[model samples]
Target: MLTNYHTLKNLIIQIKPKLIHSQIVEAFTQEKDTLHIIIAGEEASALELNATGQGYIFLRPKFERARKNSLDIFPEIFGDEIRDVLIHKADRIIEILLSSGLKLIFQFFTGKVNFFLLNQKNEIIASFKNPKDNIGKIFESEKKDSNYDLMLSDFNAFKDVWESNKIENPVLRFVKSVDTIDMLTAREILHRAGELEAGRIWKALVDVGAELENPKPRIYYEGSFPRYFSIIELTHINLRKIEFDDINEAIRKFVIETRVSKSYRDEKKTIETKLNELVEKRKRTIEKVIEEIENNQRAQQYEVYGSILMANLNLIEKGLEEVELVNMFSEKGEKIKIKLDPSLSPVENAQMYFEKAKKTKASLKIAQERLERLKFEIKQLENLLDELALCENFDALKKFKEKNLEELKKFGIVKDKLVAKVGGKFKRFIVDGGFEVWVGKDAKSNELLTFKFSDKEDLWFHARGTSGAHVVLKTGKRQPSKKAIEQAGSIAAYFSQARTSRLVPVVVTKRKYVRKPRGAPEGTVAVEREEVIMVEPKLPSEEIE
Candidate 1:
């Protein structure tokens, strides 16, 4: 669900080395039972190991730079502890760590091997399995460039070397391949293997064959020295079988949630700042207006406008303020908390302050209303931005932009420019077979198309009781077919706002009976003795050019 990069980064920071190892083991392991192994000691020291549920095992040879002294058998070199571990789980782990929050690491002993698990913010949430081997040789050979390759090669060779040894589970075999692990690789393998359920690790191997056959499967190697290695762990068989619809749905949900959070944060800040500024400005303006009104010598001449007060009065007593030299009231039935000029008469002060208060209150209300509208617009714009950012394909983005432009035009947010000269224009539409239809964009257009451009024998169609574009069907000296009539009716309905309305009524008559209404709105017309047709909305895809 975490879409932001910062959130995922925090989660990775909180991951513990042991849990990373456990995750790797769990991913590769199919066994439900616990594992037992020894670390930094012989097999007789048998350590009880818990199953990590998912994991992988990797092996590497012990080697060092040449020294002047003769080489001697070093038993102590074989007992170093494993150092690096990589875990894979839901992306949530990465999200939490990247958020700069706390995380908990859990560690325990199965027998001789140590086990560890990690949770966000250091809170103990779950337990994980332990590794079967100490991985000391692999951990100590960190300086070599070919360490990762050696590890994988060693793991693959493990089967041959340990063939005579008693190993019961197939999971152990797959675990040998784990040099490194990550969410994508884990998910790819587990999902294709159909191992989301508790049991079914072998199914993963079927696809592994297909992976090995691939000429260039994706591979990942550690970026640093003492490098670890991992392949993409996916096969062509899996790619062909895997469906991404569910993944796409998850991505969409994450995008929406992110947008909502951002919108809320932005709106909150804007509303608070704007509202505070408006309140302060209103208070100051009201005081200035009251001073001017009280000092005016011709205040009495404005009695009809509203009572001008010379002295301070409660808002309830002063009532509404009138706009200067206008009939409109400004005092919105509210009290003013401003200091009154003490030099003026009570009645004069009351009238002047009341009027000022009224104006201020009205101005404040207008400001608030405008702010609300702007906020709504901002929210819509934010959603559009989010959609643009989240759209995965270029085609979808183009369609979205086009839809937004159309909506803006419909709402009068954009001005329509006269891009072309006014002249005769006609559109010919062929519908459902060979029946040709024509339509006009305006009244003059209608007259030109129907009376002049179209033949008298052709059928004419228009929306009933509504001023809309005129449609003409050119039958060309032949009776119009039912398909042609239906097609024309659809056009008539679509041109009007009632296109989506059920059973839209359309009028059909001979081209001769239709007449443009003189001095009426563009596209308005009167038809006498026309047949009515009620039809659902739909038009043929094919149109006559």
Candidate 2:
């Protein structure tokens, strides 16, 4: 309703005489796409030019500029302003003629709203949206003939314009196609006329102008929220109305209320998007952790295999890939085939399986701890979604945001790069028995992985006697099984100089036993006690299992 020409014409007529020779002290933007200009004359007044597509302009008696986050703008026409502020014919474009051969034009046309400062030659000096092509060009307002102007007070002309247009609503025929008659004016005219007959519409159209001449400004509200404000009295939608003698005052209050409501809606949508992404990410983590826990449960089976290999070491010979033996624990007298390292003696192979079983048991505790933490995080995110539904006001949303800021940041919602940096310092993977395998990327990082990043008890691996990235099985106060070490070794072999080789020997040792010699080359480390595992050069993703 405020965008309608009749309302704008009345508003210009009311404020033009008041701003005669008023000094524009300041003009700037303090909010997103909202412009403010301060004026000092008989009374202090301000103009809020909300060029956020709605193009709502309000003249206010009192408006305090915010102390922070406000930028001063449009300094080109910031001095004295004349009272000759007029709307362009019947269009919503307001042209304010300055005494110093400059003009400030605010176009409030449909779809596109713009502000331009023009020099004496009507060339654009500056614009609000920074239209690069429009800056040096001669400004031109649209010059389409209005249906309202062509058909006013004539029944046949009104009927001809109304009949030629095919539309659903009779009110929209005037509001959408016609320029002079807006939705409010059209609805009020139809409501006053009582029907859609051409004779009645012509009479109402002629009579509506008289009503606009002496408008009783009103702001309509559904419940406590303002929905619409109009100069001419609206009889279309029934709602609570507050009448005002000053039109600008009513418009100011209504715009502020609706704009804040819109902000609240946009904020809720942002939070919901953040929460949805977080829940999906946490659920994925839970799936990975659960798979690790299931792998950890295989520790007992590894112990049984180690015991069987130790009992049958005398029967097993060296240089064998596998040995089939009767399972002592099986009631069906099942024979189990156990894989062996051909390079190791039978006793050493048995000891290696025992070591694997011990580490797998140790890794279970760490996996269980991680599983619990991930579960709690996912449940907390889901509950936060429920809590968000009750947020009604800006203060409630602000409090919700503040309360969950730390939790949201922990799950990649805020400061995402920082969260990823803390958790993803190395190329990491979860191998068998829930052990985390951390791989170095370069020569310098290889030294850090063995010395600075790894704990003393953590197992370290590298492709033996070849330039390679260091791989660390993050023991985390636990031992990792041979399967975990093998997977980590595979990752280390894949990133090394032996990557093209069919088989590579990866040396495994505790970080405590691995040390850099004095004045050693980068990534050159001497191992006091290390065991070598022979495997094909492959990454965990490339492995069959």
CA deviation > 4 Å runs, candidate 2: 29-33, 61-76, 119-126, 135-157, 164-169, 176-178, 184-195, 199-211, 216-227, 232-245, 402-406, 412-545
Backbone atom clashes (below 3 Å) for every candidate? 50, 0
What tens-digit string does per-residue lDDT give for candidate 1 at 420-454? 12122766565643465777877778767766676
lDDT per residue for candidate 2 within 1-545, as digits (tens), equals: 66767778888888888777987888888887788889888999888887765578889875889999998876876776674787887577898888777888888876677888899899998888766867898987775455665666567877877777888788897676556777767888889889877778778877776777898788888755678888877888799999999877777887888878788879788878888887787688778878887988888888888889888878999999999999999999899999999999988988888888787876776677667756776788888889888887778888887898766654445554432543545677667655667787777878877787788999988899888888888776766777778878888888899999978999988889999999999888899999999877765431111
lDDT of each: 0.43, 0.79
Off by over 4 Å in 1: 1-341, 375-379, 382-390, 398-545
Top lDDT: which candidate number?
Answer: 2
TM-scores of all candidate predictions against the true structure: 0.24, 0.68
Q: What TM-score would you give candidate 2 relative to the actual structure?
A: 0.68
Q: Which pairs of residues clash in candidate 2, taking residues 3 or more apart in a chain or in different chains?
A: none
